[model samples]
Each structure stands twice: as C-alpha cells, then as structure tokens.
Target: MSEESGSLNTTAAVGEKINAISDGSQIISAGRAISALVSEYVQESYCYRWLTKEPDPDVIVIDLRETYAFGPFITLLDQLVPHIEDAWQHSRVGAAAERVFKRLVEDVFAPLSETRGYELAAAMLAPPEPPERRNATVDDSESTEDELS
Candidate 1:
C-alpha cells in the first residue's frame, strides 16, 4: 500500500479502538497505538528536523501551529481526554496511559525551549490539578503565614 494509504488505515484502526474502549486496558492499548503513530509521523516529518535546528521559541511556536500535520495530531490527542478521565476512575491503567501520553507529547516538543515545550505539552495533556490538592496547598500556605505572624 502507498504510505498515505497505510497511514490512513492505521489511523482508522486507532480511531475504531478509541471508540470501542470500554475499560482501562483498552484505553492504554489505544494510547500506545496513538504513540506509535505519532512517533512514526515525527520521525518522517520535516517539522521535527526543523524544530531540532530552530532556536527561536517564537518561530517554533508559529511553525507548530502552522504545520499541516500538527492540526490532525492535536485533534487525535484531544479525542483521548474523555476516555482517559473515564479510565482514571476505575483502573491503574490510567496512570500508565497518562505516562505514555505525556512522554509522547514531551518528546515531540522537546526540541523547543523547555518552557515552551512544557507549555505546549501541558496545554495538550496536563490534567487539571485536583481541587482538593489545590485547596490543601492554599491552606498550608495560610497556616504557615499565621505561624510566622
């Protein structure tokens, strides 16, 4: 099959798996498939090479936004959010899937400045900080201030 046809087939397969996910194991499996597809795309795309060579954060950000492959990649990743959340509630596989997903995103954007890379990856994959944790941190800081006073 032509490369484009092969890629489409792979994407379709992954999409089907994503839609069919009913448990944490399936979520992890789908995530792995996505990582593989993204890895292949990065290895073959000019954007990766350009990202490696480019030094300017502004330029990197612009190119990332403008690249033809980026839009579809982002969309694919976006589709995983709800599934990941559902998986998190029931099994340990959510953590595994999260690690794989985060690593995949970080690797793709690693060529950019650390801050920029993190910003982009966090934007794409970082789950919101749990409200309880946020509140605990705030309470701790307030207590510390009271003690100091």
Candidate 2:
C-alpha cells in the first residue's frame, strides 16, 4: 500500500483499538450532540455529507429529539453567546486581534464555560431559512420610491 494509505490504516486501527478498550455503552448527552453538530457545521456547511446520507425526515427528528433527551441545551448556550461574539468580533479587527480572539476562545470561553461552549457551538450549526421574495418582478422604468416611502 502507499505510505499515506498505510498511515490512515494505522490510525484507524489505533482508533478501533481505543474504542474496543473503552466501554461500549456510551452516555449520549445533549451537550455532546450539540458540540458534534456544531463541529460538522463548521467543518462543512448546512448541507453536510452526513445530512445528505441520512435525508429521512424521521431520522432528522430523532436526532433533534436526542438534543432534549439529556436536558435543555439552552442554559449552556445562553452562557456561551457573549464570549463567542466577542471572540468573533475581535478576529475581524486585525491580525493581533485574531490571535487574541483565538486565545480567548480556546482559553477563556471554551474552558471556563461548558454550558455556553455547547450553546455557542450549537448556534453555529443553525441553518439559514430561504429569503421571501415577491411573485411579481419590479419595473425599472418606474420610480415609485417616494410613494413607497
């Protein structure tokens, strides 16, 4: 096999070994599910390969319901929004700001606040709805700006 293929196989084998050693029964928590969803959202888009693979409406509902199985992921989310917004805002400022933002997210926001961490992560996964448009096309020849105003 090629070197890269061999390395991937080795990694997979190691991961399997680790899983085998750990207890097979894992507690699926809302925070964990939300975190995973957020990760997938950030990694891809709303139209992720996993979503396409499992397009059944029932399955999607089941997955969403799993979020509530453990508890409301809301309280945790409420704590996370401000820190994340701050970090994101910082990144937009400059290179130094970006570094500071990354540090803040990694050290302060993520570590210090678990509930907020999951909340912020979940928000990132939310998909945008389609914008509403009028059925009729606007006429460029007419100026109705004053009338509309």
Candidate 3:
C-alpha cells in the first residue's frame, strides 16, 4: 500500500474498541498519552539528575549538557505548548491534562530553569577567582589601622 494508505490502515487497526470511541474520548485519551510520554521522558532523562541538586553548578550543567539535551528539550517544549493550549480549550480530559502539564512546568521545570546553571556553564569552566578577592575580608589598604587612629 502507499504510505498514506498504510498509515490509515495502521490507525484503523487499533482494534474495534478504540475505533468505536467518540471523538472527545479519543482527544482526551491522546492528551493523557502525551502527558505520560512527556513525564516519563523528563524523569528518565532530566528530572532524576536535576532533583539531585548537585552542589557544584559545573557538575550540574555538565551532566545536563550530555547528549545535547538542552536544545532538543527547548524545541519539544515549544512544539508541545500550543498543542496543550488547544487541548485545554477543547475537552474535560484535555483540561485535566493541561493541569498536569502546567504543574510540571511551574513546579519542576521553572525552578530548574531559574537556577540559571546553563548560563553559568562558561563561568564555572573558567579559572578560579583572582587573588585579590580571595582574602577580601582582610583590610589591604596602604594605611594601617594604627596610622588611621
């Protein structure tokens, strides 16, 4: 069969139970499927590392940058956002999925982003702080305290 017809056959072959579902149910089910996919994807790839809250920012960014995750994640999120918004405006199950999606963004994703670790990757890689700032608490002025008194 041609590619288009092949895809139609595959879709139609989901079994009679799914074929009998209403359009609203299909949309809702799709939303839940998407939500589960995203959740599993993030947890397996990103969230587990993130939730560690590693002490060193360099370590965190280095871990995250592995396999070039950041760029693709941004792309996926951008594409998903519009679909999620449309789902929210469409059906009750979609609305519930939207809530789950929003919580994922706000509670988990936002804090990870606000850490600003990605932006600091370079600074973390750079050489240590200059000598002058090392003992900043020490008074290094030309005049001593005795002279000032």
Query: Quick one: best TM-score, which candidate?
Result: 1
Ranking by TM-score: 1, 3, 2
lDDT of 1 by residue, 1-149 (tens): 69999999999999888766644576678988999999999988998887777577765336554569797787777799888878786777867887888997788656554686677977889799999999999999999999999
Model 2 lDDT-worst window of ten: 132-141
What lDDT would each prediction earn against the true structure? 0.81, 0.68, 0.76
Residue 64 lDDT, candidate 1, scale 0-100: 54
Comparison by TM-score, 2 against 3, better one: 3
- Rank ordering of all candidates by lDDT, starting from the highest: 1, 3, 2
Q: Give lDDT tens digits, candidate 3, residues 41-85.
A: 877886677786667755543544345868678778889999988
Instruction: Evaluate model 1: give its lDDT.
Output: 0.81
Top model number, lDDT: 1
Candidate 3, residue 141: how far the Cα is off, in Å: 35
Please, what is the TM-score per model?
Answer: 0.24, 0.19, 0.22
Model 1: CA > 4 A from native: 1-118
- lDDT value, residue 30 of candidate 2: 58
